[model samples]
Target: MSETILPELPQELWRAGKLELAHGVQQFLQVMRVASAGLGQYLAEIESRGVKDLYGYGTTISWFADIAGLSMGEARPYVNRAIDLNPTRALDGTEIPPFAPATGAAAAEGAIGAERIKQILEILRQIPAEVSVEDREHAEAKLAGLARDAGPRQVSDLGEQVLGWLDPDGKEPKDPEPAQPRRELTLQRRKDGYWNLKGLLDDEAGARTAAALEAYAKPRPVDEFGQADLRTKAERQGDAWVDLVDLAIACPDQPGTNGYRTLVHVTIGLEELKTGLGTACLDFVGTMTAREARLAACDCLMLPVVLNAAGEPLDVGRLRRFVTPGQRRALNIRDRGCTFPGCHRRPKNCHAHHIHHWADGGPTDLRNLTLLCSFHHRLIHHGDWQVRMAADGLPEFIPPQYLDPLQRTRRNTLI
Candidate 1:
């Protein structure tokens, strides 16, 4: 193949008119498309020769990710695109054609962009296996030709039309037996300190879950401050899930292991728990911030196993931190709901937070305890907010200096 030199940027680019700038951008995009196609050819050759042989990496995508300073997920698409658009060699030295030769050709000419190419390739892949080879090729060619002038969405719409014309009826299931229900769930933690939850449930299970979540996910009533829940539907659902987990843990009938109620156990240093400045180990899971551990420990939502410098269990304080039922009822009667100003969270949705933490020798009585919703509970722990009992035997919050320079104390009048 002959080398093609790319054009240099126009001199005094800052002085270019609007139309000229638009024309320049179009020209540069065409150059990029051509270059992308050329890169795919090189990548195909590398794969054919064996990436392990050349770079000592197990996979071309992995090596590319490392060399290009990209995440594995970001690098995968480029490598996949290359393999799908370029010819490869079989182990027996036979030539294996690209999956969509017509699309690849259009991509090479810079007549289509990457998104359009992806749409065309996906359309080609969806063609029924039982369809004739000639029909598949014709469909692929038509999609690619349309992609040259149309957007990806238009190309996709045309492709779907072609598919409907070719097959008319969808593929029939091979098995005569009725399909079985499928239910699956996956929860994974990433290095960036976030958890990904994905799941699929059968119809019966799905309906039950939707009902449960919807019950708790309803928007909060307008508060004294005129603010509604303000959380999006998705955020409300997430909070509802947390509430459901809290309820399950608080249930007496919930299953247990090793003679203890099913609950998250956090192993934290005594200093970390006190100062909220280090990390803590979440039993059987991973790690959490010391501040979070402090918050989790305040209410024993996660039972804390406090450690000394020698890594010995200095204090478990599981039973000692627990507020008695009598005390909880009194707390609910007095405080009613979340003590945070304007919060409307009810007793069931709130955690009994120790004003002076139980770990710090604070009593578990009503005066020392207050009800706080999960959001306010986290805010009180992580943000500059403060909460305390008043002279009138009620819980009140003090806004940070920024919110109120005088730092005036406020009560939940809404309750």
Candidate 2:
């Protein structure tokens, strides 16, 4: 072919009308598609000649990456596309047809871009392996025809419908089971003392976990201060997991807790416990802020051991910190559920939270406590929410100014 040449654009190129500008851009893209097909053909020739022996590279993709300045990720699809579109000669010197002849022709003529080609190839791949060769070819041709007019997304949607037509039941033969169940989990402590968790649960476990988490993971209601749940789904799920662990530990019949429903032991200095500042040791494994220790101390979710500054055990007098059963029953009847505005948690799902933390010398009386779910309990301690007993002897919440410019007192109406 004669060498293709182009004249330089006039400075007025930028002043072109909308239709002219759009048409020029479209033509350029078509040129790119044609060049891509030519590149694919070259790559296929390299592959046929043996990539390693011809270019001292392990794979044709590696050679393309080095020469074309593309990353291996970008080069891999090009190499595969070439193999799928280009005919090859067998060892017996017989010709083998391209896997997708219609797609190859369209790509060579610049009628489809790389993305459309990829979508067509993917549809062809989904054809049942046991289907006759003619059926597979028909699917490929149909998809290529659709690609000529539709975008990749539309082509993909059509592919799904095609599957149902090809296999009405959409059921494939089950493969043999592997040696072990495909569930795995990894928890490792980082250098910063935080634990990183990664895991994969099998289908049943995953579904159960998802259902439980979703039960506790609804979006927080907009507080009276106009603050909605600002947390992302991931953050909500993390909080849900914490709630799940607490629920498991709170189960009276749980086997491993040795009659203590709590799972962790937090040891804090008497000063830290009272002041809500400073650090506390956690099960001798790591440390937590005294504020966190105070939260855990509430409802006695974590066994707390008070210590003097000298690291000696200190008697913290009578453990009147926990609300008595009768006091909890009264609070349950009074608050009904989480006293946070718009919260729908029931009484059974609540913790009797001390309005004034008991660690701060607040008494655990009916007037001093309110019912809060595990999520709201943590929010009262760690978030910007404030709670108090109203003059009428009922619990009320005060949203932070950011949530409510007026910072007005709000009551949960869900009860």
Best by TM-score: 2
Global Cα lDDT for candidate 1: 0.82
Candidate-wise lDDT, in order? 0.82, 0.80
Mind giving the per-residue lDDT tens digits that candidate 2 earns over 1-415? 1122232344798788898778777777777788888888888878887788887999999999999899999889999999999886666767778889999989987889988888788777777778888777787788888888888788888888877777667655576754455789999988799889899988888999899999888887775446688889999988888777766765657787632335567878899888889998888899999988887766764666789889888753334476655776687777788888888888767777888888887887888888888878888998998998889999888887877799888888888
Cα error, residue 40 of model 2, in Å, equals: 0.9
- Lowest summed lDDT window (length 10), candidate 2: 1-10
TM-score of 2: 0.75
What TM-score, computed on C-alpha atoms, does each candidate reach?
A: 0.56, 0.75
Off by over 4 Å in 1: 1-8, 12-19, 34-109, 129-142, 174-254, 257-294, 301-318, 324-338, 342-350, 373-375, 378-384, 390-393, 412-415
Which pairs of residues collide in model 2? 225-403, 225-404
Worst 10 residues of 1 by lDDT: 254-263
Model 2, residue 83: distance off in Å is 1.0
Clashes of 2: 2
